[model samples]
Target: MGGLSDRFWNGAAAQLVNAIIAAVNARDFDALERYATADLLFCDSRGGQISGLARVIDWLRDVIAADPSFALQVDAVTSSNGSALVTGTTVSRFFPEARRTLWRLTFSGGRVSEWRRYSADPLPVPPPLTAH
Candidate 1:
């Protein structure tokens, strides 16, 4: 029964990752809050660690407002026993040189308890304009 429950949690955690991406893309901070625990910890790519929903909401709001083209793409997810890790890439127009970010999420009670993210690779530069 424990194994079955673990599997179920793993799947749910994976889905939560997608939900988070969608919320960010939509700039829906309120909806994103639904997936977080009260004491959630967020470790950003810039080496900043912030805790709690209000802080997270403020951070996300600032981020979204600063970069109108910010977008996230989930690449993969894995989970076991009350925790999950998600890998993904984030793209933003504001800092195009450092846009590709990989994220890892940890879950507890079907809510995100911790999130750590960093760039998996150097962000790509847009090609120079070509004469048509």
Candidate 2:
């Protein structure tokens, strides 16, 4: 595992990313038990952070259960060096609009060691530049 090449690691990372998204969308976080390390840490864009796989799983469950229409549409995944970065659009009935979130994951011993999600809300476009 540790001796794997960048290509191999990246591929593995991508697979992990997809599996995580699927589980989250299904609201079955228990399926992620194998993917997360015992001491995994998850940090959210809302300044919320949780450590330990069990705690993280609980937190995810609450977030997913909050909105019945909650869904994540993954746009891209980039992986390398034991880490993966995933960007996706989040649609939730609880929110007024769609939001983009970037998920960064680090892997160790073939399980996710840390996960960070950064949420980015869309901003209105500004008017075109004009000479004063």
Could you say which candidate leads in lDDT? 2
Q: Which stretches of candidate 2 lie above 4 Å from their native place?
A: 1-4, 121-132
- For residue 122, model 1's alpha carbon misses the true position, in angstroms, by 10
Judged by lDDT against the true structure, how good is candidate 1? 0.70
The Cα error of candidate 2 at residue 17, in Å, is 0.7
Model 1 RMSD vs true structure: 9.0
- Return the TM-score for candidate 1, rounded to 2 decimals: 0.77
Q: If scored against the real structure, what TM-score would every candidate get? A: 0.77, 0.80
lDDT of 1 by residue, 1-132 (tens): 378887787778778888977987888877888988888887655446777878777777776666677678777888776666666666777554535556777777778888777764422232122233
Give lDDT tens digits, candidate 2, residues 1-132: 345577686777788888877887887767788778999888665555677888777766666556567777788888877788998887877568788788898999988899887875421211122233
